[model samples]
Target: MGFIKKLGYGLLAIVAAVALFVLLCAMNPNLTKGLSEILYGKDGNSGLIGSNTSEEVSAGSPGLSTPAEIGLPAADSGIDASSLVPYMPYNGTITTIPENVLGRNGYTPVTGTGEVLSEAQAKETEESIDKGSDGSNLEFDPEIYPYYAMLDSTCQALYKQIYANACDLVSSFAPCKIVNTDQVQYTFEAVFADHPELFYVQTAYTEKYTSDKKVVEIDMAYYTIANDLENARNSFDSAATAIEEGARQFPDDYSKEKYVHDTLIQTVVYDASAPMDQSAYSALVNGRSVCAGYARAYQYVMQKLGIPTYYCAGTSGEDHAWNIVKLGDGYYNVDVTWDDTDPSSYDYFNKTDGDYAGTHVRKSLSVYLPACNGTQYRNLESSAPVSDLEDESSSPSQPVSDAEPNHYDPYFDPYINNDPQKPLDYESEHPESSPTATNTSGNSNTTASPSNAAAQLAVYGLKESDAVTTLQDYYNDCKVQLVSCGMGDHCFYNIVPESLFKTIESEYGKQNYLGGYMNSALKTIGASNCNIVIQAERLGGGYYRIWHNVYVW
Candidate 1:
């Protein structure tokens, strides 16, 4: 009887120990995840009900939803679809909306880890928020601040809050108002995109929300600790100031912009593992960074010099970031990271949308950025401008009249400009000696019209109208125009019939047909790659004007 009682007592003790362990796991959320890791391996299926581990708590605990529930936007939401940038997770995967939530209006979920706060926890977190003034005095220019301009008034206010907090390096704060995960995410992104000076803060943030899912607390992450922030800022300012001062010495706007571009390429080396890889500080101070660092560095210096430069994030085979600078009146794309190749290249310097068609595509809120169409300053360093190639006054035979812009004179042979070897004055100096043109005598060396005019005739081949009727003809017309214009860096303009306008535009989206046609022309010039950008506009009478800026290498 004594032995039996002893064994029973031991078993009872064992059972109590098991129950205590279970109770502790239920209370501590992290304990459950730790158990999951032990059972399923460190990287195993930690998710039982939802994807976000922070939201995944034991049964009956008040927890946030996984994949974070985003309600449809209200009818009065006024959220532009373009303004909704995708949330990029720290692991580098893009967080997508659930299939069920597609087409519904709502905010996008910001990518980060945080918990749904209890009422008491919310009160505690709220107290920690610094109500101090730091970035309150900062002003934003709507024209220059593309991301800020995308936000509605409410979100704009949130942007100011996030910006101010980040500038001050406030560890945690309550949002100025009750905002969903979507507004917080977008506003946070806008703040970073618009302001490159917020280098210490990281993109991922932690949010504590009420059980009802209203975000109550935000903890902004930082790359630099508070003690080291001032030193980092001083270093950043020194480097940026030096670059800005150097750029100001240049005589023209293009020269100053180019100087900054060249300086960045020379200073920064592409290092994916560099500390603070996303911040301009990494590129400017450490001399090592990835695409984000390069872009932000360019943006900061240009903005300091009072050049309107915006950071552009997108995908180029992988995630990438670049800049769009307002040189003169038009915006032009400049990828300092890409141009910093071995021996350096101007492949992406001062390019247009058509110039970057397939290679670089803007994603998220960046799509709303102005289309880079400025051609005046493109490739200025690599080659002489067409105006510099020959004397414009030398072309007396084919005089350009301001009133008759499109007036074609077959006898004058305007295509003579296509040949770089032949001087424009050659025709006037030695009229009969010119190979590309004919003298006033009706006897002509060339039987066809000029490049552009002849291509126009081919598109309207035997048709009573001037529009391209089929996709095949449209493709052929573009290639012929490029080839006829000597396959050099030039713009090839074509008009599509109203019926085929949308279809031709669709081909550009497909990306295949344009490449095939551009490549065919490229082969003639003995170049393997080319920068070809096609921009189109709708004309009255069902006609569409399409133009291609083709630069071959």
Candidate 2:
């Protein structure tokens, strides 16, 4: 029994000690209940009463102050409440309302029974009505009303509604808000100062009103007008400069005509095609240009320089374009496209209409320049019908005699005509003879027979003279050939008949002894009516040993 009591007492003492420890832990704020559980061998897995694990604890005492609560700096703390206001769905409501109702009285009753109300209640009701009114009774001040009304209705309504939603209204006052209330007054003042034109009552409004409406309206109008005018002035100045530059670049007055001619030649690169246009002739911009571009650009620049120039488009071959420029007292056909060749050649720039028109048969100026009347120029080619031969006759080698016949020739004389069948009577009568025939009236008596006289005259006519002249001219012209042959020791010969030599000698002077030797040599050869061939040998002594041959005809 003694052993049992001792053991029982010992167990009770242990329990009491545990209870005291728990109470002590509970009484100390720093000693958590979890510490006692761990000491007593409990699982302690519940949150703050958990076993000694590596997990972090975040729960703090209820009375502890957080960093934010203690006024430590925080993000977005200074943001405006109005900015955080939620977007309200669109609803039709006049937002800007006057504090005083337009026609409502403060003494008005709440019902149709007309029960009289206390002044304070009446005033409170009036303020409530004003706050709820759709702002229809609002009156804008005269000074700011015009500028505000000038805004687009949509923008105006939006602005007013935004202001109303953002504004604070007193619940117990007569009028909800005055026209000159702080927000409305500041906005009205700002809008007026910025855009004074809005106050002037313009009918139509622009985007200028929505942004910096005042500044935009004031600056845009004047700036736009001034800018446009400045551009126009600059364009005119540039055109004038181009004209002056052109004149200076090509200082020669005759250059214009030369340009015209050369342009025409190049225009017809070949007979197979028509002339090139402005784009094709751009290569000549520095040197020259086609008639159309030249005339148009020229006229444009000249007009800037106060010179009267016209582009004339008329028909020539197919269709062509040119210009007619006004000089001092006359207007000449200034076909610059035609005159762009070598100036020294008669085909250079400054040719008359007759010179150009004569080259072709159907040389009409109808398609040359379309702008100007053909009658404007004095030398304008008559629009008379010309033959195709005349139109296609631009060949430089072609003769002018084949052109229009003489005005006096009534029968269209066949003798002077280019027609091969209608040969001259004189030419047909002496068919065997050359182109030249001597007049026999003076030398007719010298021969015994008429036939013999005719034969002699025909044989000794201008054709023979021409042949002799041609030979002499060739000799004179080729002095270098003669000298070279003599130095090289080549043979030379004279091959004229003795009779012809005698006639030549009689007409001129007596021949030297060498001439007699030549005659003797010809007799030895038994040849008459021959061509002379001269040969010379190049002997060592700066002299040529001479030889001659007589070739009989």
Candidate 3:
């Protein structure tokens, strides 16, 4: 009986010890986890319920529906990371709409990047934006024409396709959907029909997707371009350096431009079948290329000199290319290729929009670049008429004063004395060209009633403060003459002296206030990049109507 009693007590003691151990582990999970790790190493305990580890918790939580239920985007939902957009810090909270948004620094992008554009005062930007009334078909969009016009036709098509495919790259870093092979192939062909200028893309193909546009597990393939950008960039650098060496032969943009114009005509011949003639490389390197090469080379050199210039392409009867040059007080279309015929002629050089009219048919994709109206540099020391020039005999016998009743500003001296090769006639040497002239300057358009430019910014998703800042900035920078400041469903209409367009660039240099105005407008609207679409109209002698959708891009 004593032996049996001892055995029973021992068994009871063992049971109590076991129960205590179990209670300790239950109270403190760390105890069990530590024990498990000691006994079985890492991965010893599978996900125990209610663990705070996201990796473990993410798999499943007792009654949890999905990641979405936990305020997280669902797994396998394309986006994999926290953010997919480029780093653009939000300026502030969005509140009531602003009065004026664009704080004009005078520099607005023609359409794309690296194109010598107008910088928003704070140095913001405009890229590719479609100002189409009908959003369905982007190709037919008229507002984007100026952007397209700035590039060679092939690049115009390329930029359009890439712009239309903005969704393909931005799934929050998710795997891109496999696109239709046909569409991908078409884009590739269109983009490289003659090799793109800005895209820098090499080989492109569809990755993973099944047939049937619908119900197919997909990845977007359009903007997922494989860039073969290195070699071409190297080539452009070399070309620019080489051109700059030669450009040093002349002083200012005007002189350098004329020298380049004449040199290109003297050096490069117009060839119908020049090899690889669509690039600046062919024109600058090989000294043999077609119109495209000439135009590209011209733009490259001009931009280096701090002069605003563009490679403009269009159908001059058939496929052709040329340049847009800002010289003296105006923008003109210069066809180095056309001017390079036997003996070479200046007839096609420095022509206005009206001058190039009926001759240059702008590509549909080009941005609506302002018309080339100022005839100052027309024909460059030759037969082209300086339309504003009065007959030498009609000049006032003596000098004019600020109080004079002349139709033009007395502050602006017309550079009346003439020297044949000097188009501006030493205007830089005179007092009229002083930066102070900007303050005294007045345009007839300013006499019109001024409207509140801020009211129109609401369409661009701006608060009243931002709107006021933008318009006030632009008004201060551009000194625009208000024709109207009315709002539409998604745009604004305003008027300024057309003369402002021509002089703003020259007066303020590249540091003009319009650049700030544009950047502010972009921030107000929350666009990731800058591409403000503005439509310009010739309001007759030195007046313009600008129809703009300020935040489309």
Q: Report, for every candidate in turn, its global Cα lDDT versus the true structure.
A: 0.63, 0.30, 0.42
RMSD to truth, every model: 17.7, 41.1, 24.4
lDDT of 1 by residue, 1-553 (tens): 9999999999999999999999998899899877787666454434443334543222222332112221223333334544443322122232343332122111122256679888998887788765444454567897778788877777777788888877776787777766777677777777778888888888788888887777887778888444598887898899999989877765556666877877787778887678878888889999998888888999999899888999887666556788899976488998887777665656678898777765666655666577787755565443221121134345232211111223232322332121121133312233444322332233553333344334434443422255677888888887788777663467666766645765654444333352447557756756544554444432323344565656656
TM-score for every candidate vs. truth?
Answer: 0.52, 0.19, 0.34
Candidate 1 Cα misplacement greater than 4 A, ranges: 1-110, 127-137, 383-553
Lowest summed lDDT across 10 adjacent residues in model 1 is found at 397-406
What digit string (tens of lDDT, one per residue) describes model 2 on residues 176-288? 22221222322332232222122111112111111211111111012121234445345434543543554443333323332233333333221112222232222222323
lDDT of 3 by residue, 1-553 (tens): 9999999999999999999999999999999978776665455334343224434323233432233321222222222133211111111112222122111011111221112223331122112222222113445332222333334333344345444443223211111223333333333333332232432222233222233421111112322222333565676667666656666655455556766676666556666566556656567756877777787677767766666666554455455567777775667888777766544556577777655654554442221244566553453232322211224333221111112221233333433212112232212233434332222223222222223222222223332343222334445432231112111124454444434444432322222222434334433444323222333333323233444332223
Q: Please identify model 2 stretches exceeding 4 Å from their true place.
A: 1-240, 246-289, 342-351, 359-553
Q: Which regions of candidate 3 fall more than 4 Å away from where they truly are?
A: 1-236, 383-553
